[model samples]
Target chain A: MRLRNLGFVLLFVAGFAHADTAPFDLSDAEHIKAGHKRFNKTCAAYCHGFQGSGGRAPALNAPDGLPPEQMFTVITEGRRGAEVMPPWGTSFTPEQIWELIAYIQSLRSTAPAAP
Target chain B: MRLLESIRTSLLSLIATASLAATAAAPSIDQAGSADPTNWPQYHRSYNAWRYSPLEQIDKSNVKHLKVAWIHQPGNITHGLQATPIEIDGVLYYISADNNVWAIQADTGTTLWHYVPKLDPIVKEVFYGSASRGVTVGLGKVFLGTLDGRFIALDQKTGKALWSTQLTDQRNEAGALFSSPPQLAGNVLFGGTTGGDQPTIGKIFAVDAETGARLWTFEIPKDDLKSWPGESRKTAGSSAWMPGTYDPVSDTIYIGTSNAAPDYHPYSRLGNNLYSATVLALDPKTGKIKWHRQEVENDSWDFDSAYEALLLKRDGQDLLVHLNKGGFVYVLEKNTGKIQNVWRYAENLNWTDGIDKKTGKLINPVRPEVEKSKLLCPNLLGARSWNHGAYNPKTGLWYTHGMEVCNYITSAPEEPGPKPINALTLGLEEIRLTDPPGKKADGWFGAFDPITGAQKWKIRYDMPGLCSTLTTSTGLVFTGDMRGNLYAYDGDDGKTLWQFNAGSACRGGPISYSVNGKQYIVIPTGLGSHAPGFLAGAFPGIKDLPGGATLIAFTLE
Candidate 1:
């Protein structure tokens, strides 16, 4: 009985933690600005270039990149098995992570036209 | 007739001298203690890993005239070059960022041959990053550990693949990788596996030099928590990521271990977590632990004892010297891991009250509290990261390059999973604490007495000295920074003698060697790795310099 109840609790947590259920506004200008700062300080310089293009890691500003939901999961919980992307949940809150995602999305929108 | 004879005699003497210098010998394993002016054969250029050269061709007075000899830009590897190129017979052998072996002419920056490992889909997907510390050259072959966990041997003369063996499988448990350069001692090659962040248990291996065969393996204790009796510990992270120093006299490999598993939360794994944050004296043949000393017991902060264990001789007594990321320099008996002295090198450190003189263990006062901000000094990146320090036998001083930053570390409750969310948490999410007062500098370069662990002299920098320190018998010391400035200082008094703007962060391995009677100092300028990323968050003054992977060689003009 106890084991079954614990399983239910985990299921409930997982349900609410879905990427679709992510809170806050990705379209917010202030939120995106805040994320840009965080991303540049933590992620941009190491894996991605400071401009969010790419160096050691893949380019983050691709027009048709992963949805914000998948990005949320990858950012929070590092991809297991192929452990390239480390989990940043402990380092940044969900709100801050969403801000970073928004900044990355903005980069895609502002990307220069390919000649 | 007399004038013609004299001219011939002088010319003959000059010709003989040139021949003798050209045929100079490569450094042997037995000659590690004594300084070699010509060759940089080993990782630390010696078995002791002192990183000190007896060559004084470019001394303090003449270092001002040092100029760029040549610059070799490795094509494929883009982000930082970490390999300390080993020189032999006017040929330097080193591995690039992507596991590509390059045999370049030491005199001219001409690439003789390049060997790139063709990886399968599985290896490609799993092999994450590119940053090899260096390669070991001996037994007529150049040896290196691949990022995909493979031990490979290549022909030194021709970049031909001789033997290859898989060291560790990442699929086992989480995964394991090899970034540390393999140390070749006698007939066996010693190497350590990295992946403490992967949360896998750490291990050290001894491989046969002749054939790529596993000789012996030593696993750090999984549950060394003496306080927690009868509890079987599943995972204890103690990765030996850095290349260890070899002591020929003691016949032991001195290597330091990384932090314990579930890093931030010490509540899960209690006790000293013996051998995790400890240095071990292991027999190279059988990989048996002879003696071990735990520096930090129940390490709340991510203080790994994983730095270069330099073997130094003081007053005719052999001693093993190590600088902990936790901000302490320990002097121990080379034969035994008995602590002779321990001293703090960081200017302001509050992670612990201090190390107990009697126990040789840290007086750890701070414990991981759930959701509570615990400000600690000599932050997570460590007072000193894995950047190699140099020991000058002439001055009896050890030069270390490191940071002096602090952090507010807070850990969450333990959770069960492969990569637990709350295992080890960087307290960046917590409320921002004010920087320590008068912290005009975030980095420091220090020279300390290896015998008494006393600070002889030090210099502060706005940015941390990230590159390994290299010293020469000519009373000149060399180190580099994140701002891409390579500096030459007076070894005794720590005075800046000369500087160079390499146009990028020079944080990789810096080594010196002589080819064709010319002394040259080589430094790799590029930026990549975890420390710089941490600095980006902690210090706002830190610059995001452009990416590079160029090896710049310097000599007196």
Candidate 2:
């Protein structure tokens, strides 16, 4: 009975941990497409160049220095002293912001590898 | 019988004297339109805003021999120079991009005096962002509207402060500030504000030309709009950001009003936002609206129809020729808001099918219900920006610059916070996601016949033609482009007769004047501006553009 109770506790812990981890499918075509649309619609052309080249805003096609989580934070809350990059916490939802990060990551992978 | 005769003579004398006083108070339309050939006293070089000079010593035949006479380098200005220097009595007076007034010698390009306004840090940060277009000379003083909402008067000869009065509320939190030059009409100094980017309503202020006292104010109507529902009315913006044209004969001021606020989102401001993107004819002294014609209603695109309304007397009828951001040239009856005719000036206009001639309404296609992306031509940068077009009476043609571009724009949610980090207007976002990007945006400097709606002649360029034009009676047209090339075009055929690379983009209006029998053409050149930066992406060839402000004058060598 003690062993059975311990098994149940372990199962509960595993479920909680799984729930905490966001279920982001990096390889999913639909997820990537949604992100591409959002990024292109909101991010590109005005500040960023047509193909993520530098403009009034910086280039984002190259590899990002920050990790996915940090980028998510930056896109969601925006960094202090950065007036140009407005906080998208209210402009976009959490899922959409995460998707944008995934799209940005895809841009890096799709870009020609550095010489 | 003797007493009665004396009384009647006194009454007749009084009547005659009053008539003389009224006539002297205001210069006739003919006098204002064609000022002394040596003086560019007003913003457009005249009250008619024709931007055409009669000095023709450097005619089509001699224009090829033009060479740089002198270069006035205004070092401290960190932005582009937009001033078309007003030459008065051999002295050239203008303002810098940052609202610093400079009085210089018209002959030698020597800086006589520079007056910089001392403003609080907050005011400087919020209000004075764009370039000052030009300055006004009137009532023995040079009038300059500052970014801190003050209309200041300076001694025309000494550049010393005469009087300074606040035109806007000192506690302005929504960033309403002056962007254009002030116009002196009769005894009043007229100017308008530019705060469409912020949450403020646009207003035009009339200040006393002599004392700099606020005389009358005209606020753009925001209430009782059936289109914009409730709260959006508060954010309605119809800023008169350009110096208007005046007709003393009609006793009317033709002021062009800018787009509505929160530029992109139309759901927030629903109704045909009246007077936001309209041309208003007003009484200069009383601020009463005589008539108004809105060019673009419920402006979703940032198409401000606030360019100078070129007033022309066509076939004995007062006709106002206006080119709007949406790429449409509207010919209206100047006295009445009657649309005489309309034509598509730009080649790639797709935002509307056509204009309803009877109602003066844009025939815009039905917007998608779900707010998907819609492709439109002549994007927010506009087919024609703030660059002034010159009308040549001799050639009977209008010389202007035009752009060809399209935008895939989608509506986003209105920005939530009052002071978002990116305080840019929200709702519509331009997307570059369209497959097979349409032809790269190109530019054209062309002469169009307003009556026929036809392009008579044009010189095409890979880089966008982004500058004002000046036409002279000598059959030579002067214009500049984003690539820093100023061209003297043959006014008849639009052929580039001579070109000079000014080492910077020439965005300011070109003016011509003769000082001591030497005809000189002044072109303001500077590299810094959003138009050039965006065009750099559109045209890959424009690179290594030099920075700083320069006023280059040319004369026949």
Model 2 lDDT tens row, B482-520: 778899999899888899998878878888887777889
Indicate the worst ten consecutive residues by lDDT in candidate 2 chain B: B429-438
DockQ metric, candidate 1: 0.08
Tens digit per residue, CA lDDT, model 1, A76-96: 755432114555554455676
Clashing pairs in 2: B227-B270, B227-B271, B228-B270, B228-B271, B412-B427
lDDT of 2: 0.72
Model 2 ranges off by over 4 Å: A1-52, A56-115, B1-33, B127-130, B169-173, B366-371, B420-422, B433-438, B540-544
TM-score of 1: 0.80
User: Which regions of candidate 1 deviate over 4 angstroms?
Assistant: A1-115, B1-33, B120-128, B222-232, B420-434, B437-441
TM-score against native, each model: 0.80, 0.82
Taking chain B only, the TM-score of every model is: 0.90, 0.91
lDDT per model, in order?
A: 0.71, 0.72
Give the docking tier of candidate 1. Answer: incorrect
